[model samples]
Target: MKQKRSRYIIGIDLGTTNSAIAYMDTRKNPTGGADAIRTFSVPQLVAEGEVKEREGLPSFLYLSTGQDLPVGSLDLAWAKERNFAVGEFARIQGAKVPGRLVSSAKSWLCHQGVDRKAPILPWGSDMEELSKCSPVDASALYMGHVRDAWNYLMAGSDPSDRFEEQDVILTVPASFDAVARELTLDAAGKAGITRITLVEEPQAAFYYWITDNEENWSGIVGPGKIILVCDIGGGTTDFTLIRVREGDAAPTPERIAVGEHLLLGGDNMDLALARLVESRILGEKENRLDSLRWLILASLCRNAKEKILSGGDVQQVGINLPGRGKGIVAGTLSDSINMEDIEQTVINGFLPDTRFDETPVRGRGSGICEWGLPFVADPVIPRHLAAFLKKHAAEQMDSSRADGRFPLRPDAIFFNGGVFTPRIIRKRISAMLSNWFSHDTDPAFQPLVLENNSPALAVARGATYYGMVRRGRGVRIVGGCARSYYVKVAENRAALEPGQITAACVIPRGMEEGEEMEIEAPEFKVL
Candidate 1:
């Protein structure tokens, strides 16, 4: 027998608007340990035209007629056309053909008062009509994505592949809330993932930072130090300050705590810009005609966003607003809407250019007009931007020490998020960081500890790399969360059962991580 090899650790980057998964196989490096890990990432978007109801795929499946499926990539049959809309309950929704859809259910898990499993996608209502889904039926939705990825890997397995050794580490935003984390763990379980862990997005990036020190940063943290991690992505922003240290005891680099601002991200910026286009192009006429008009609007938002990213101004917004009394709204999307209008829509209404805490910042004019409706001038949009920036600054400060603690700064942030990629956005963020650490003088505070080098894949790469570390370490104890389940030991075999303890973990909670504490299982059987 050519002994089957146990292998692979899957890392999922589940963002607000986009998501991806990367894994490592031992074949990459036999001599090196965890450092030999490799990675691959694809947008979590499923296109309708290529949908196919396969084993791991979600419903609304599409197949590319007769084409061989692209195994480790997004089925981009409809990527060229995508739009964002205010769904049924005014929630921002994106349109997808039959099986083509993208979701970041990870972000919705933290809504206050509302059930995390409730229909929370922006267009939950309208989509309910389209898919004839229940008001709160998200079970078959995003969960299907997990299945899809798992199945994708399984399908590629050879007869000699030993899946028993495969493990998974899920990267969640550092700021994930209680219910949000719960729901995500639920989703992971639903995906049939038996060995899964949730690592803060920033922390995962840190592993990458530690791995590629010298080239990416000034120096690595000497064993113990405090570090701040800021990750801005498509749908939200996550920030955390952590202490970094290495040990194989059981998932080292203790995650002190993480904080986040719900619904703050580049996607929001896109939304504001989209709305600005709608206001300028449609103006006073939006009460008429609507067939493929929705589709056209989607295209406009995508185009306008691209224009801004390209370092150029868009003159006209091509929308399909028919019968709206607005003369050129439907017919003309070419170079017609006057670049001035687009500029104001962004600069004045969407994301107003402004200053924060005496530090200057920039926002797309498109963001200004889109976010600031009835769009007033004289510090209109800038005020909103200022509030957001200030809120983040305050949150970071509040989370810095966490009750009289000099946790020590991290060697480097190990930064990786969508916002870090765009050249313009990167520069803007750099300026903001300049202001953020202007006061720290510990010589430990990294001036600008970030990894713009490999923005999106950083987290996935770190995770995949780390997975290689546990190859022969036996069954390791991944962090535990509520409503979560792991195989229980019985009959000398593992049995499936949900976690029992609800009180903020006992033994583990009471003693220092390195110190072991005896625990007596308290039972209160629910009737």
Candidate 2:
């Protein structure tokens, strides 16, 4: 019997500690709103004792003395409760190398061979410590998640249904260089994702913001309007100047320029806070902060951070040390020195505007200088992004204002990314941008911004939108106005290695694949 083509579109947001997937609904077209981007965060993490069980059969798997019984997420979660799980619930803990565990998969994507090697952690784990698992290839590790995402979609889908044509659109940070983009696409392909288009995270966030506001991409974009997008995510923060021009077809939008800081994210902030906590509170007791323990503290500080920023002292919003049983701690944090402490933690740790043209923020190659986003900016990360964006922006924009690009500013800024949690980071982002653009002499340098519109999940949502647009299956905000050029695969190029660049292939003209136009050229292979 012949099989049918698959029609499923999978959107995945592979994050630091979590991963999620969403796609086009065969039953209902997700209204082109914030709601359209529905996803399952449970994709990357499975807690202990939470695995679904069948009524008649054994509820779990066994691998021990008598073939041990094991449940998925619940197993680890339960282990943590019972104190059986060690070093991050049986995962690696307290390793000097980020390579040991796949905590910063996206950051590793910035490297050559590393991007292909760093994404293998929860898939299989042993108590062998973090060092045994540390491999230099970040791309391979990342591929595991993409593969998992694809498998998840296939598993959840109806088996009796005929396979339908599905296209994939992957999202990544703006600072990603040619190598990173290639590696990301390669990873997607390895995971069974067929057709793909890489959209910058900030760009996807902008679409989400516009789609939410207008109900569709067509609503907000028409005639002459400027929409600036500033996406300060966990790993990287970027700014893009989008201009809606009414010259041809629909309101065509162009990406004028983009700015970002790689190392400035929530994680960066967390590290800073963690260190402070270690020095001021824990001090000599630092050794007690194991991986799992540190994770718990980071989680608590993150939870209370936003509340503290909002001028509210959290109720029961405090640290939890599993072994120590410190469930939660609270102080006169809101009214007293709490907010000040938090503010100082962020302001001082990040170095704000004062950090330009120096250290991680400056003189780095493409794709962010620091992987540490200010969200938890201690122990800084492998990538520092802001300086990368600013440098690129300076090169592309004429800050002198002599050229039309001089005013290079976005109309309305959109912020979304996996790292944009706790919501307080949004405020921190606005403050940073105020400093970034204020240094400019041009009157048009002002940027309009919005905060956390499903920050972590925006890319997955936009990917679904992009897939539909590409396949002509659903309506997207990319109505009459879209990129004038057709969505063509990169052209003839040599066989690309893990992170090598193969040229872009052009789609035949006149054949809009549900996008602006169809492939006009003969279907030629890119590899």
Candidate 3:
């Protein structure tokens, strides 16, 4: 029996802080070009009883109490009688009530320390009798909301045009391990998206670049050029290196290395700014903020940071904190943050300029540490990049060196994620990289910046192009498994004595998809 092809190919970028959707209609452009892709504006609840369309849906969920809103205020166009909300309204209202909000669910989904399936989100909250959801459930709810939004706007009365019935591709971090990838698939399944494929977010960004410059991509990036994809989003920072190969007709890109999963990004910067604002508000007072108040202040700081870094004429944004008193207007606290605060806290503190040999500082660990997401101790992003380059130096070395001791130098850099949206931030990073390379290897070597049209939404659009590439329509980046698979084996020893355990590599790194290998090891006797 012959099966009918899907009408549309959809791409979903399930980011840590935001999510977006893009699709291509196969009937309109059968050959598939970058111009055929279209971004879908999601319709979500912006406020109580108010619905609005936004390009990116904030990845946040708010569990509403019985008295949170008026009757029938949480109703959407597709569904009614809702007790919870997921989208802009959730982010806005959840800021006030942090105990019931579920933010950074994507980061929690990949956290192996906690049970991802257990209802433990809103971590470290003291509100009792409050309904809670697992990380997997929160992620599923976000995806489910995206599916419903697409169906409501695009599907209409035609069942065949439903989002779930179309071909879909989802993007994940290149550094996500096997367990995290499995949980992402589980979340998608729970959202009723049965048929789907997973593409690394870094690869998707590169795909978008290729799609956007399909005509002169070869001229922009030629063979022997190594492009580094630096993706720093709200909750995670991902790095991937792609080397261009000399093909007969066109230049081919191959993924060389991927950095470790480092849970550091704009969220850390928000916390830093919050602390700065807190010091200003409480000025020399010993009285400290409770957990709930601290969370509220942090949310307000995030808003301020965004406004200041948005490259607008506004130099300062006012932040107000609700008082603990019975009256709403009495005892309210207020403060303002200017551009200097952002420069000192986010730019100088998080992304400071350092030498290429400098590495991230590791603080001494205590025996008993807090149980939560394992964020990087040192927040300096350039130091981490230096360390990553040092680790992967053996992969691609500078041929100019006689002894071949020089590190891998990137010919160009492609920046993605919301953190790089600010021009100052991008300029600082570019200057730092150029300084490092020019001082060490060549005097005139400068990395070319591959301009991205939409830094925040590139992953989703790139994922859509990747879907077309899967159908043998566009250029494909040859990236298989990012990491290698290993197994622990015990050395030959007496049964009474302890055996020496060693890690044995079963599958080498960069193993292509659908490739298989058989392990040849001696069987050990069970003691």
Candidate 4:
């Protein structure tokens, strides 16, 4: 028996807040080209019993109580008698019933302290009747939905065209550790996608930029130039620095550094806006809102934030919180969020001007702590960026700088993520970067912005292009392990102290895939 050839190469962007799929027909494009790649519109339940197509699927899952909707409302063409929902409808309905909603699964998947395989999602929920799932389970559900949707729309009656049989590339955060990466692979395997390759989200975004500018990318970026990839998504912020060096044919790009995983992004901004509105509506003396009500308010604030930052003419959006009793309309609490509130709360709060040497302030931890997803102590994005640059300055510093006093200054910035959709927000971040550089060395130095055609879809599209590149199609960015590894060694003595253990570098940073290195360490004898 012979194996069937894959008809397509697919890329999946399993984002924290939303997910997207892109693919290229191998049969159609024997010789791959960036123009041949296309985005797939996913069919999902938009409302009860109604199915519609959307470009991106919201990464939220709602576990139904079997009484929330009408019969056959949750049914899909691929499955029947369903008790759960994923995508747009899930996000919309879960906002009202926060106890049953599984959100930020990606963030929880990377959390080290918690058992990712344990059923602890909908964290801190007290609902006994509702079913709970693990962080890995939530991710697998999302991936399985994409697989079913693809088979239903593209496979037709041909079993060979199923998504599981295709060459797939999935994107993950660059800062994710080995445990997190392994968990992600487990989720994909559970979804029936065993043949898959994982790519860093930041690198995928850079690949998309290269494919988008294949004609003139070499002209725009020459040798010895550093490009900073700033990725601020719904639930996480990632920073990567890439350097362009001269190659045999054209300039080659190499990834030099990646920042630590910081759980701070649009979700944090939404919560901040919600708190601002809550304070205005309920006075300081009023009782605080319960957990359910707080989640509902945050959802409403998310909608308002999108509207205000959408570059529309609307100045404000109204928020109406439903009461728990029968007379809901009469007991409803109402408030409005204006453009001013958005600017003061989200823009000024997260992305503010700061000096290059200034570090992010770490808040004091309480004696009694709670077990949950570990969020960043400081929410200032600029401060975090400054710290990332300072840490990697020695390796990426320009040869012209002999003083070694200034941090690594990027020649250009490539912004990718939904958080950077608004022109005002992008300009604010650019201005902040420019201010920091001007104060450091050159007064006229300003990092150029590499225009992204679509920030929301870049990762998926880039992943697909990378799949093609693996098949001998396009240029590949040289990047491997994001961080170095170390092993603890004890001192050879008759009596050892508690503080005598030291770590030896086993694997150096930037070691490419498939590369081997010899470690010189004493061998231990087992009894």
Q: What is the C-alpha lDDT of each candidate?
A: 0.45, 0.45, 0.86, 0.86
Q: What is model 2's C-alpha RMSD?
A: 9.6
Q: Per-residue lDDT for 1-527 in model 4, tens only?
A: 74455789899999999999999998998777788889999999999888999999999999898887888899999999899999999999899898888898999998877899999978877888888999999999999999999999999888889999999999999999889999999999999998799999999999999989988887888888889999999989999999988888878889989998888888888888878877877767465566677788989999999998898898899999887544322367899999999888888888866777789878741111222556788888999999999898877677785345565778899999989998988898888888777754578778899999988899999999998888777887886778888877665655676666667887788787668987766654465
What lDDT, from 0 to 1, does candidate 3 have?
0.86
Candidate 3, residues 395-492, lDDT tens digits: the string is: 56756632343367788999999999998998998888888777444677678999999887799999999989878889889867888888777764
Estimate candidate 1's RMSD in Å: 10.6
**Which candidate number maximizes TM-score?**
4
Please provide TM-scores, in order, for all candidate models, with all chains considered together. 0.61, 0.61, 0.93, 0.93
**What digit string (tens of lDDT, one per residue) describes model 2 on residues 245-266?**
5645556555555543344565
Candidate 3 colliding pairs: none
lDDT of 1 by residue, 328-417 (tens): 544643223344544464334433443444322234322232112211122232233344444444433435443232212233444457
**Superior candidate under TM-score, 2 versus 3:** 3
Runs of candidate 3 with Cα error greater than 4 angstroms are 1-5, 325-330, 364-371, 398-405, 487-499, 502-506, 516-527
Better candidate by TM-score, 1 or 4: 4
